[model samples]
Each structure stands twice: as structure tokens, then as C-alpha cells.
Target: MKPQSMLFTIYGEYVRHYGSEIWIGSLTKLMGEFGLSEPAVRAAISRMLRQGWLESRKVGNRSYYSVSERGKKRLEEAAARIYKVETDVWDGKWCIASYNIPEERRALRDQLRKELGWMGFGMLTTSTWISPNNLSDRVKELTEAHEITEYVEIFTSEHMGWSNPKQLVQKCWDIDEINEKYKSFIDAYREEYEQLSAKMSNGEAVPDSHCFVEKTKLVHQYRKFLFIDPDLPQELLPELWLGKEADELFQNYYQLLNPGAVRFFETVYEAAPSA
Candidate 1:
């Protein structure tokens, strides 16, 4: 993995397990497991802390860091943007060409499929190939993202096509279903937010641990969209699918976790989806 992707994975794991409250020893252990050096680990942690993705507390002689409420919200937003549903019409001209992957790398092939699905590849058949409606830039993205630029082949043909538009629509409806699932979450969150606001207005004591509640709420709010379709392979996500706007959203979410940065990210998240 590249440095940026590695950092994202590391931070993602930390947030998932420790929710930002991490110690040096734990970080060191993570580094060892990931085969990262102490300096690299420390640098990544410091960078995230500086970027407001983490908050540090000094008690006695030890320091611990945890994801702030803002951080948690940002993470939720990032997850949504990364896995949000996209409505694209398939153009039916292009198709994916996969080769005989080694038995040892079968897991890798599965990973590729999941990635591809995230990137918009529909599995037409098992190992033979996968494709999206319009293959233009998505193809290039898959190549680089999977590091199979030279290994995989792309062809324009109609050898095996989906004859049932209804079935195809249903298959592609995962995004819509996922969006609906999250809508309920968002609605519940709205209700909770209203209650929380009313309590605050009544001069009720809002405990510091409420931050955890906020984090949990955000996770629940977006958890429905976290994973790709289980049936899909993981490694086939097109890198280009995460365009500049997505990158901007990710960065904005990271920054928005700081106090006073919420509005900025909210606007970005609510902005029109990419083309």
C-alpha cells in the first residue's frame, strides 16, 4: 500500500478499536504488526493530531489521544463519501477481462472484486470478468488502484450481456437500498439531536462523555454504508472513482472535526455528488 493508503488504514483501525484514545505502547504494537517503523508511526499520529483528527490528554507522565467528537463525525462523513451510492446508467459496450490468478492469490482476487464493486464493477461472471455500464475512466482507475494495470485486459464486446433490465436494475439497486438504510439512521439521529438540544437549552449538564454518544451516533448514522456488497470482490475498486471532489471531501471531513469546522464539511458533504 502507498503511504497515504497505509496511513488511512492505520488511522481507521485506531479509530475503530480505540476510538482515538490510544497510547504509545498500543501504537507501537500496531506499527510492529503493520511493519511500520516507530518514527513513521509517530509521525503519522502527530500529523493526525495536528490535523484535529485526534485529541491528546496528558495525565501524570503519560499522554493518550482519542478521536474528538469532531473527529468521529468527520470519520462518519468520510465513510459515507467513500461508500456512498452512485446512480449511473450502464453503457453496455465495455467489459472486464481477468486472467488466471494463482491459487495462492485467490484471496487477493476476492479483494479485487470487492474493490471493483466499490468502484462500480458489476460481476457478470465469477472469475472471468466484471464491468460497469460505461467503462471510460473507471477502467484506468481499476488498473492503477489494483496495481494490475498490465495484468488485466479490457475489451469492447457484447459476448455476455445482461438481457434482463429488471434484474440488472435490481442488482444495481444495492446503492439505493443502502441509502434507504442510512436514511432511517439519519432520521433517528435527528430525533436525538433535537432531544439533546432541548436538554442543553434547559441548562441541563451535558457531560464530557456526551462526546462518546455523539461519536456513536455518527457511526450508527453511517454504518449502513460502510461495507461493499459482501458478494462482490474487494480489490476491484476503481481508483479514479474517488475523484478530486472525493479527496476534497475526505480532507474537508478531516479538518471539519475540529470545533468550528463542522459547517464547512457539512456543505461539502451535501454538495452535489460527482458526475
Candidate 2:
């Protein structure tokens, strides 16, 4: 994994739970488990700082970093979805965003598109994005943050088209493609989960450091779904959707590895001098 992406996973899974702050040296040391070089970690930290995802502080000779408020909001949003087992009831409404940004402001336009996708909106056209989820608050936040309120319009309404909801869903996202990705995850991890469960049940000893690496890798791999899966409501999803199954396996595996992982992480984290 790239240092920046791994850092996000680390923050979301670990540091975000334990004070949301860490010494720079502790971060580098933890990152070493994934074979990320200290220089790469530093560079990634600098990039995140410039992007406003991280804020830095200094105490005497040591530097410390923490997720910014903006970053914390994003991380909290992601965590809610990441750990979500039950799909929320759909009100049969779509949240639509339409923008007429001028070509001269192409950079702003591109950023808006990215933000829309991150907020689970799928592109129906170059300037029109839609989602089945209620995202009015997030849309308002995006518009206000980017100063694009005048260029964008938000609507929440039922689609009155000839096509059915499933058809509309198919058009917006490749359900089959997303399902195949979930299948891949299940195929890769099912055996690992069974093996680990067997080990634990048999009283076999697994190293805390090893469990930390496994759990981190598991979370890193599973978190990629946040980018690809828009997480449509159950009524819109196909009957054989593997997302719930994948989530079950992920949760079980995570719980199996969590205790040891926490111990290992705390050992490294608490040893660092407070800054």
C-alpha cells in the first residue's frame, strides 16, 4: 500500500481511537511494519499537511501530528459506513446534484466531481450526479467549502422515469462489477479467517506483532471498498449481493485479530515519549 493510504488506514483504525495524536517517530516506527520507509512516511505526512488532512505540532525537538477537524469528519463518516451491517431503509428518493460550472473553472469542476464521487454520487452525465442516499447535508457542506454554491443545484426527488429503480441503479453503478470485487475478497479471506479461528480455538499462540500486521492488512484491504462501493440501499441491490457476507467475514476476522493487534500497537504507541 502507498504510505499515504496506509496512513489513512492506520489513523482510522488505530490512532483515531487512541487520542488521535501521535509522535512523528511513533508513526514512522509503526509504518515500518508495512515496509514503508521513514522518508516515505515523512513525505506522505508533508503531503497530507499541505492537503489539510493532517496538522503538525512541535514540543521541544520532537514533532507530533494529528488528524485535522476536516479529516476527522471524513474519517467518522467513513467509519460509520465501514462498520455498518444493516442497510438503512430507502425512502425511494434520489439526491441529485447538477452543476453548470464554467469551463474556465475546470479545476473546481474536477474537484467537485471527485467530492461527489466520494460522497457516493454516481455520474449520470458530465455535470449531473445522483445517489439513492440522502446526502443533502454533505452536498451543502461541499458547496459551502468550495464556494460553488452558485454553480450547483441540489434536488431530492423520486425518479419518475419509465425505467425501474434497479435499471437506474445499473446505469449509475456496475453492480456486477462491485459484486465480483466482493467475491474476490471473500475468496481470499474466508480461508484465512477459518485458519485463524482454528488456531485460536486450539490454543495456539500467535504473536501480537503478527496479529497487528494481519489486522492492519485486513482493514487496509477492506477499506478499499469505500472507494468502489457506493453502498446502495437493500431494496436497490441485487438479491445475491455479497457485500453483507464480505462484511461478516471482515468483522469476524477483525475481532479475532483485534486483541493482539491492540496490545502490539499500544506497546509501540505508549513507549513513545509524550510531546
- Identify the leading candidate in terms of lDDT: 2
Put down candidate 2 lDDT per residue, 103-222, tens digits, no spaces.
999999999988888888888888899999999889999899999899999999989998899998888888899999999999999999999899999999999999999999999999
lDDT tens digits, residue span 39-139, model 1: 87777778877866777776656556666666676466456455545544444454555655567767757766665665445555665445544444555
RMSD of each: 12.7, 1.4
Worst 10 residues of 2 by lDDT: 266-275
**lDDT of each candidate versus the true structure:** 0.49, 0.92
**How displaced is residue 57 in candidate 1, in Å?**
19
Query: Global CA lDDT of candidate 1, please?
Result: 0.49
Best by TM-score: 2
Q: What TM-score should be assigned to candidate 1?
A: 0.43
Query: Which parts of model 1 have CA positions greater than 4 angstroms off?
Result: 1-100, 128-147, 155-167, 172-180, 183-190, 201-205, 220-224, 229-275
